[model samples]
Target chain A: MNRLRFAPIPAGLPATVPFTGPETLERRRGAPFRARLGANENGFGPSPKAVEAMARASADVWKYGDPDSHDLREALAAHHVISPANIMLGEGIDGLLGLLVRLVMAPGETVVTSEGAYPTFNYHVAGFDGRLHKVPYRDDAEDLEALIAAGHETGARLIYFANPDNPMGSWLTGERIEAALSHLPDGALLILDEAYAEFAPEAAIPRIDPEDDRVIRFRTFSKAYGMAGARIGYAIGPAELIAGFDRIRNHFGINRTAQIGALAALQDQEWLERTRLKVGKTRDRIAAIAASNGLRALPSATNFVAVDCGQGGDFARRVLAQLAAQGIFARMPGVPPMDRCIRISCGPDHELDAFAEALPVALAGARED
Target chain B: MNRLRFAPIPAGLPATVPFTGPETLERRRGAPFRARLGANENGFGPSPKAVEAMARASADVWKYGDPDSHDLREALAAHHVISPANIMLGEGIDGLLGLLVRLVMAPGETVVTSEGAYPTFNYHVAGFDGRLHKVPYRDDAEDLEALIAAGHETGARLIYFANPDNPMGSWLTGERIEAALSHLPDGALLILDEAYAEFAPEAAIPRIDPEDDRVIRFRTFSKAYGMAGARIGYAIGPAELIAGFDRIRNHFGINRTAQIGALAALQDQEWLERTRLKVGKTRDRIAAIAASNGLRALPSATNFVAVDCGQGGDFARRVLAQLAAQGIFARMPGVPPMDRCIRISCGPDHELDAFAEALPVALAGARED
Candidate 1:
């Protein structure tokens, strides 16, 4: 029963992570899942140029990546038409959220997020001993207005909003976010999690304003750019707020391959466009498959689609387990109403073929159960 | 100035990073360094197998790395002959230090380390608003006894000691470390940073017992493994102490390429041993070069040699700047006494030749200054 002395918050906390990765599950199942679609990772892959760049960079992996991430940050700034000072590159969006939470959330400070939104953000809030206030999703979308209201109600220091959100694949318009910015209370920072922004529609992505102090936007190479394994992401906000990350961030955290790979990915806008189109098609295919099975697939602006199983949480859980039993990996929202639907990520035609073949079988099993 | 609310510590803190990277200096100077030897990176380079492994992993970058880091951790466990439960992987030693500091040192709590020893560790403690008490290096080596005594005096939560220390390239015997562990008072953890352990002599590396609760050991691929840019490191300690990291660490922090690269690197111990021998020879060459110039090279059990300019900090600073002016990027320690010596990493013959060509001229320039 010997234990090392740790901060009270971390000491008392459970060692539960937000998601048990597919690899962990595969080990438990004693077999690899046929489709690597869970976790919302893109299956179409990154730009050939990025893979080439990473392979080229491997020879120089003996040197530490530039700590300032100077070149990558500069490229991101130009790509987004903002000053480099307004950007801070981090390990990933998950890692950046951890830093953002740490920067503003002192012990007992309130942080507001949608109840079933990104759980990693909640993990970080609790890591820093911040009090969490969750506003439930409204009609399957992260209700931005409700999130703002909850932030105000709790006197929260930070509000988490993901445009084209996870699990549900719902989105809010840029106008909705821009108009809502007016009431961002003093002393509160809105963390706009735009990890999947590229897959989201143009209307869902608000204009960039580096001078905007009330909100910070996070974007990653993980989704539409198809570089989730690279672990590269950046935050754009007011220069002062971005500068605050320099106080606590792991300056050398970005991998050398990630830097070069991400830079190449940014340079390949054509590839990004093509991937977006492919994701759109695959998302449609998934919805069609769900419809054929007598399920309703929700509209999606992300690379994933949520299909209502025409059942409650219990039946949805059984369907999900059946999908796993059929060697198809998929996920669902953890909490109530959202859990009544099964989530599937957009994948290549072959993987989608596997899902297509497995869906009816999994559904039949769920119905039998 | 317009600003968002930040935690008290980060709010009051200067937006300073531990190391202003060599690339930042190059940008300011409008040139790249002729000799890439300042950051203690193994310019000897990663194994071709590792490079091949990373290049191979590039196409798979669409998948998030296993959050559990299952295969790599298992390989590392077998490599170190320890149970996997006793290990936790991270971005690097720098990132792990941040997590460790967050886990143990709440605001105002004390942590101890040698002055001018691994500023990044100090940076993490400061980021967490922990009070830091530093004991001056005894004989240009981290004074283990003084550090342990200082822990008692300050009631510090953690004590940091680097084997084959950075900036100065000195080490303490494992027997010395084992003897000191007896007095590591309850509630205090000793962070035994052996980042350069692979390059150190056999006697210097202590046998690790994962059941030991008094200390945690950190190792990185950035040192002798020659994968500095890959950003993979791991901590080993009692299962309980290691589990604490799961509560705060970025679960998916380890990059996919880094995992595969490190695993490939571990499987190629021949490459590691070859790098170690090359480093030893390079260290000898660097020492020989210093001796030929009438300077003294400090005893080293590392990939780098710290050469005394036979003067004070001011003279060494001049030598460092002169090297910079000559496009030779060398670094000196930050505090006095240790500051009298300049550090040079072991690189290829050509880079050391550039250093050889520049050292005497730089020394002459320093003498004149």
Candidate 2:
């Protein structure tokens, strides 16, 4: 009776978050990290025009955002080759994942995902009381065949996959993904999370058939667009399933500045391309640095590179701790095999330089333990 | 199934929203409304300082908000004279309500509220499969005694009452509310949504002991502080219950612009007081306008006034539609007796002047029908 009682799902869950942000580390250490090369965020920042738009909209923040988010959706639709009806924008991909889980997965329903994947999606499934079935990665890539097989076997209402996937920075070609699509079970929605799609090679993004009701694709401004702080991301699917979000989403949850910022960001395709190129350059630099430090960096099509430390999860943890102690913010995958690597995001040159200098010293310090 | 499937909790719920934005109406009508005074937003807008902060942070928009919303929560804690652990911020009260209902209510558990209170909360309860137990309003005011009695009788796990309540704009003294609190079930949590508390008279606010685990208070910057578009609201409660949100909330869901705008908004109490005065003046003008049109305007402690249309829900609906058609947006209650009144928000002189000019013609149009 002393503790406030929670429902069964919440009661069974831990208070731990999926990832610790750099801000949390700063508070704990009482000093800011010299480099923020984790969380796969676009540290190079958003376009100046988008920043100006956000500032202009800031004074008018007292009013509620258009619950419909008409303008941004229209802009996003045009930016991608999709209809606005195919989109359902939310707080972020994290928020959209929560809604998708809620709309499709009833309590005790089954959900399928990789053994070590985006924890937020797993968190959503758990929140909605859906039982999860995880498939292990096949040679560092998400095992699509296993995911489809698991979804069919479990009759999962949801099967989640991140293209140009996080943690391992591995991805499969669009043709392979399209071929794997046939194996998916009917009534089971495939959540193709493409949060890092903009940074991915062209072939990594499939031609999403508008009529495909069984698959929904997600994209975020948080990644290549460099607007994660704006918390805008959207899902693309058939009209009926996409429209289902209207039943439960916080109608006015989209912030006004986010709407304006995202719209402007979408219009600035040049900036997006530049950021993508910069990310590719940074990824190569990170890989080279890892090689010089005797670590193998996994091939990455996204903003972050996963460097294999030739060790286990515990060794990666020690290396991560050592890096944190040296005022560098980095992260590693959770769960086995994948945890043998540390993840570093593409940042501005200075931040990358900081990471370069710290990696060797941190590795030495970690080895001393 | 040809029809799209929904989760059990969301099944059978209407695919309708409580309020439609003017933009949506514009899309339907193919034209925009000229004057906006419907949703009780501050047309006076957010502070210049806030807008500047948001603009400055826009470039950093690619970075995710601190999942913990550490800075804002600490600032809010300082403002409210409580520890950081006592506060939990969400997208808005609307989002928090959804989470709270999910956290506390099991399927079919009873929740008590005024019959025509905020429908968003009701929608959330239904989304979580909670049975909503309603109590009729007493003389346009939330019937607290009945709400408390219903909670005790039905063993309701949660009870909601809004101070300076919405729609009818009626409120009771805080001391009376405090006295009625004893009637609630011992284990039931009382959610006092104080979204309009900033504009309410001093006596309307209860001096609750923050350590009381049984009560949680919801406050928003959306109204008086003019940051509704920012989507920032916080709940104050005992540490145990507040921490429970961490277990399920989209930790980084709050956008960066919102954090910056709200922080600046909080620091400017002077603007808030000015807004209160403006709201008061505008409310009186709305009442005078109602009197000139031969309708009775009810007293209000909130930013909006409910003017009796001398008819039923149908007549008020007609009046509202007529005004909306004429480009003066307004709304009314959805349920009985209270629905006889059309709600008008306080706006700048020009916006209210448009309402003043539009009311009689709209009333006449309603009379003809």
Candidate 2's displacement at residue A149, Å, is 1.9
Give the alpha carbon lDDT tens digit for every residue of B310-366 in model 2. Answer: 999999999999998899888788888999999998888988888888898999999
Q: At residue B161, what lDDT does model 1 achieve?
A: 93
The Cα RMSD across the true interface for model 1 is: 1.9
Best by lDDT: 1
**Model 2 spans > 4 angstroms off:** A1-3, B1-4
List each candidate's DockQ score: 0.73, 0.71
Q: Single out the weakest 10-residue window by summed lDDT for candidate 1 chain A.
A: A1-10
Which lDDT tens digits does candidate 1 get at residues A12-47?
688787899999889989999999778889998999
Off by over 4 Å in 1: A1-3, B1-3
TM for every model, in the order presented, reads 0.99, 0.97
Q: What's the true lDDT of residue B128 in model 2?
A: 81
lDDT of 1 at A95: 95
Lowest summed-lDDT stretch of 10 residues in model 2 chain B?
B1-10
Q: Best DockQ goes to which candidate?
A: 1
